[model samples]
Target: MAQAATITIGSKVRVLRVRDRIPADLVEALKADPTGTVTGFRTVDGQGIGLEVDLGAGKGAWFFDDEVTLA
Candidate 1:
């Protein structure tokens, strides 16, 4: 399997797909514009890593590592 790209704060990324449920507006926004900058990281379930992406216009959301890729 291909390994995911390494990401860090300020890195540009694009949403690949959402694995968890989120607000409808966020989902729509992602579908319309999937690219964003990595703002930070979060611990998910103590085993997974979640990325905080700034979608611009004050819009932001967290996505699992597998849900995004380097842009």
Candidate 2:
């Protein structure tokens, strides 16, 4: 089994699934969230990517990766 890869925003990534593949609505939902405070970007296992987001209303190291593929 493949290990879960860590992803972050602004980590240079690409979209893997299409509108029909996953659902156009789903994609839109993810886009709705704003990239606030999320400054840096990073990846894990090269499977997916993510971004280091601001810890707003939360704690500990956190990130947000809207894209599904690597950039």
Candidate 3:
């Protein structure tokens, strides 16, 4: 398995891939510009890491560390 990328707040990143069940409004925006800046970090019970990816156009989403790369 590929090692997970390390992400930090304000880190620049590009989407490597995405899950299928994303919100409808974000689909085109995500595809148009996969690059985004990490705005915050999230965790489930302080466990797995989830990232706050901020793309322009009021678009942002939480992505797994494996779904993005440091840019």
Residue pairs with colliding backbones in model 2 are: 7-49, 7-50, 8-49, 8-50, 8-51, 9-50, 9-51, 12-71, 13-70, 13-71
Order of candidates by lDDT, top first? 1, 3, 2
**Between candidates 2 and 3, the TM-score winner:** 3
lDDT of 1 by residue, 1-71 (tens): 13234688999999999977899989888888999999998888987778899998788999888888899
The CA-based lDDT of model 1 is what?
0.86
The TM-score between candidate 3 and the true structure equals 0.81
lDDT of 2 by residue, 10-70 (tens): 3433343332243454445445532234446566458654444442344213332442344
Candidate RMSDs in Å, in order, are 2.2, 9.0, 2.7
Query: What lDDT does each candidate get?
Result: 0.86, 0.40, 0.80
Cα shift from native, residue 11, model 3 (Å): 0.8
Give model 3 RMSD, 1 decimal.
2.7
Better lDDT candidate (2, 3): 3
List TM-scores for all candidates, in order: 0.88, 0.31, 0.81
